[model samples]
Target: MTTPPLSLRARRAIVMTAAVLCPLVAGAQTIAKPAIGPERPFTAPARVERTLSNGLRVVAVRYPTVPKVSVVVTMQSGLAVDPVEKAGLAQFVADAVQEGTASRDSRVIRREIFAMGASLTAFAGQDTSSFTMRGLADTLPAMMSLVADVVRNPTFPQQEVDLLKANTAQALQAQLASPQFVANRVYRQTLFGPHPYGRVGAAPETVANIDRASIVEYHKTYYRPNNAFVVVTGDVTPDAAFAAAEKAFGTWARGTVPPPPTAALPALTGRKLVFVQRPNSVQSSISVGNFTIRRSDPRWAVMNVANQIYGGAFDSRLVRNIREDKGYTYSPQSTFQAMGQAGLYRAVADVRNDVTGATLKEIYGEIDRFREGGPAEAELVNAKTYARGLFVIQNATQNGLSATLNTIYSFGLPNDYPETFQKNVSSLSAEAVKTAAQMLLGSQDSVIVVVGDYTKVKDQLVGFTNITFVDISGKPITPPQ
Candidate 1:
């Protein structure tokens, strides 16, 4: 017998169902898993490095993959150079540097940048302040000119300075309301003591005290051609790039910027617990860390691989144990931040308040296990593979290549760092990784910072020694008598 014709709605439903099922059926057919091939050796891009008569170092790479160029001008000055009384002066200067130049007002500068369909941004970190511009290759000259003008001649207009300070104050208020922010700020202060890195961010009062004079003086001192370098990448010949840079910045006069004084970093004697009370909070923000080696340390590669196996990725022991097995957190991860002087190794997690202490115990247990036994042979291989894959993937694009080059320059890495990195990571043994972990991740020297309701988690934390009560700002507070 012939079947009756289906109604329009029924036909539509059948069509949709088929659309979904077709992919499923097709996918069910056994597909060959692509074979993991041997990693191709990375070849560094040919670069032309030259110094202008004025002492500005310029590095240019001719990457013809895309019809664009990116220029990064990095100054050796950063937050670490901020004067003691004006703690956020460098950050304030970074903000004001983009406001206006002697030759152009803020509005006109922004208009010209947008006219070229380019982006310009300036930021200051612990070790460096940088201004970057990216645009079509045809506009490279114009973009470079704009960058030079901003970096060299920022007027630090008083009105703009006031506005920046007001905005920063408002933002600070918003950030202070977050438990995570409080935890991080307090953690840095506790870890570094009076070092500049310990400040982590600007205090509102510091921002308020910043003025145009301080910003301009800072610019004159640190933003000299001698103390800065320009990295250019993308569709430009080295000669042409060098010419553009010379025309735009060669006239900048050289000046001495005495390095900032370094404070003796406080030593971590034993495991310490710092509690910041956040009333009625459901989740606790926890940061456990200790000061580690600088970026230039030889053990960095080994430490990186070991960190990945320990807590760096989704499959890391911390995540696998705390999230997948115990459901304590969605993710728990660790990072090794290598700076110019000293760096830090941190393991961070946000978990339900009830599980705060348990999570910390598990984290400590995982570290102890890794220290005792190191990574298994299979785990070591996987970490090496992941590290190598990341290196390849990160430098595959023009922007990524530029960023990598910038990092190399910023950290004073060897000219052959990319090649060296690959060789080192590939040859790293399980024992080497374990040695790095044992040296850097010992619980005895780590500081643990927790931000949550102290009443809910205090009993759980009683096992930890040197427990201290502190406010969100890191000032010690007395417990209720």
Candidate 2:
């Protein structure tokens, strides 16, 4: 059945009618999202402290309100301490601890922990590591004993080592399959460069090659009483807590602190733009950042404020620009991560495939803005308020106390850390924060990396004078196309 063809005027009328109705249809379908409730700050219980003859430091937090208790034995070591060849040694040792023991088998340990409803785990690092035990206050003693056994006498049995090696290899393979993982891994390598922090959590080759001897050696070298700090916080009194810890770990022999090797921070070589071409990525993961002050650096406070205003929270500059305005992604964030010796300030975001080039350009612009002039008074006050609010919440409970201890031990913070922070944070001025921002936010010295389908993004990225293409391994993808 053939109908008479409409004239051009009829077709124009049809198109206009379609356009007029489309907006109406869209408006009808759109619904405003519900407002989320205001955020509440967390508060910690009052703290009590004591020191034992063996130089064991004990801190007890009284929280008669909550039934749960959290205990931690944090030593000054963590992933940051992994040996050069064994990059993930701390993590591997952490995971392998409960595999078995001299007396109790791995299954027995697991069953006991299960029956007592205890959660226990161990983690190691360069500056600090810890074994954490958490459970009902009444069951804390039992959990403590279990953790004590693991820390004092882990038997990373041959069978367990084999199992862990296989498991680690499998985990490594899984992470390698992820674009985000590859992207971040490469960024760390480039940012940290020759620094230990630059290496991935676990070296694929090293993890596959690790055995019981290495784990045992690592444990013995660093896990000593004098070199560690034990903190317990819960319903118990200070005396009781000390006695309990002594009964479980008093016998731990004090050993000299390891003279860890010296670290030389390499000056950032140059400003560079790079990309890892994922065959079929729907979006791009971008990282723009530079090395920052060490954990103990005095500049940390200023950097903290600067980072917050830049992209510290949901309402930060990056999120506001990339998400609230352009709607490129849900949220874009930046963070300053420098552990024991040094950390890097980095901004990371995932943008739609088409927006990669523009997104990075905007990111660079923001960084440049900070270097050129720095944040205004409004941003400075807001960040300080936000940070103070965070400090209160972070120190609010037993978990919070454990966190405090962890941070202290990890970064070798001074005893007056909390007191000092309170004073510093309160007295922080806009001028001080701005100075910190100007010093740390140098865009000309920063690095940029983009991971996505380069074929679609390459033409857009041509504006950058320097662009290096990298494969998933961080090796150069080609001789600059």
The candidate that wins on TM-score is 1
For model 1, state the Cα shift of residue 162 in Å: 0.5
Q: Give lDDT tens digits, candidate 1, residues 348-434.
A: 999998999999999899989999999999899899989988888888778889999998888898888876778889899877888
lDDT of each: 0.87, 0.77
Give TM-scores for every candidate, taking all chains together and pairing residue i with residue i: 0.95, 0.86
Q: Which stretches of candidate 1 lie over 4 Å from their true place?
A: 1-32
Candidate 1 lDDT: 0.87
lDDT of 2 by residue, 426-454 (tens): 57776676677776665777778888888
* Counted clashes in each candidate structure: 0, 18
In candidate 1, list every pair of residues with a backbone clash: none
Model 1 residue 157 lDDT?
A: 84
Off by over 4 Å in 2: 1-55, 420-423, 479-481
Q: State the weakest 10-residue window (summed lDDT) of model 1.
A: 472-481
Report how far residue 260 has shifted in candidate 1, in Å.
2.5
